[model samples]
Target: MSNDRVLNICFHGVGEPQRELEPGEDVYWVTADRFAAILDEVSTWPVPVRLSFDDGNASDVEIGLPALVERGLTAEFFLLAGRLDTPGSVDSAGVAKLRSAGMPIGSHGMAHRSWRGLSAAETTAEFDTARTVLAEAAGAPITTAACPLGRYDRRVLSALRDRGYTRIYTSDRRPARSGAWLQPRYSVRHHDTPASMRSGVLAPAPLPARARALAVGTVKRWR
Candidate 1:
């Protein structure tokens, strides 16, 4: 990887779900063993890798945190403010614990709804109030976010920018620019293995594939 490039790896639930999952959400949940192997593989990468956990699943604290700690790695945990304290999700105490363990806390919005074309009120609740709720639980300012369900459009991006989020993460499945405000991430899924991750993420993309990825991101931003 080039010095200016960085790989963003995102995880969702690890192991079994404690609560009911949304439709099609099971694809993002990986087994504990798979999660561990992937972490170990990424730790040996020759390039810069930024790690993050999304959806605020309880496993993030129960399983994910320990694996990361054991590997002497830290990640950003994006908490869903509305889901805090809900069964099967990370609660307020879990959020605090993640922060205390040196993991940065970020807002994953109030609910795990798509941030595509929200109304005015919905936008305020998801973008503004969600950050407030998460910051209070984390006991720190929340200045970053990962789009729910990897969905976003021009309006959504504009709202996040106007809110002054220092970094915005998306499941765009491409490498990211080191200092860019909008970061694209490859989310680990149930079928992904260490080798698949290495070949898919660690290996450099072909020039045509790279161009296609960039075009996709550009379309999402402006469409």
Candidate 2:
């Protein structure tokens, strides 16, 4: 992927059915499985970003997958092991649907705990358990993780390497660099317009050739 032209955009909470929250109550509260149809209407740019969701929601299979399949688009989901069989978590039927649709689910963590404050052993346990559980559910190698709440340090990185995680996603706004495991992702929210979505994904790099693209993006963000 061309670092400048390509982007990585991901959605959160596309799992099970849930009520929509009141405005201003939450920032990015998309219902877990219902976003697939909504995304169908979105006009993809030439250099599309990788789409992803967090918290393996049941609707991912019921709603999200059909939409993605129709459009020939796909997404990745991060699963929380502790929530797998509990209320509000994606059930066995839901997970099977996701696999059948060809979605790649990764680990979110064992309990959705903050990874930054945990001891090395605690972090390792959390990562390993979630990875194992999600992999078994998805029936594939769960080799990546989106660090819980986007917090990580050297110790967490070490733990990931030891546990054999191959990719790591973060919420950092910076563009990704080559060979960097901490791949940055842009989060979508309720207020973002389609135009704003385009600008956010195509984060312009500073160069003599792309000055106008950068200016247009800045203006779009303020509108």
lDDT of each: 0.90, 0.67
**Regions more than 4 Å wrong, model 2:** 1-5, 14-25, 31-43, 177-179, 203-223
Estimated TM-score for each candidate: 0.90, 0.78
Model 1 gets an lDDT of 0.90
TM-score of 2: 0.78
- Model 1 RMSD to the real structure? 7.8
Candidate 1: list runs displaced more than 4 Å: 205-223
Error of 1 at 160 (Å): 0.7
The top-ranked prediction according to lDDT is 1
57-88 in candidate 2: lDDT tens per residue? 55555566776787888888777787787665
Report the C-alpha lDDT of model 1 over 41-120, residue by residue, as the tens digit: 88876567999999999999999988988889999999999999999999888887898899999999998899988889
Clash tally for model 2: 9
Model 1 poorest ten-residue lDDT run: 214-223
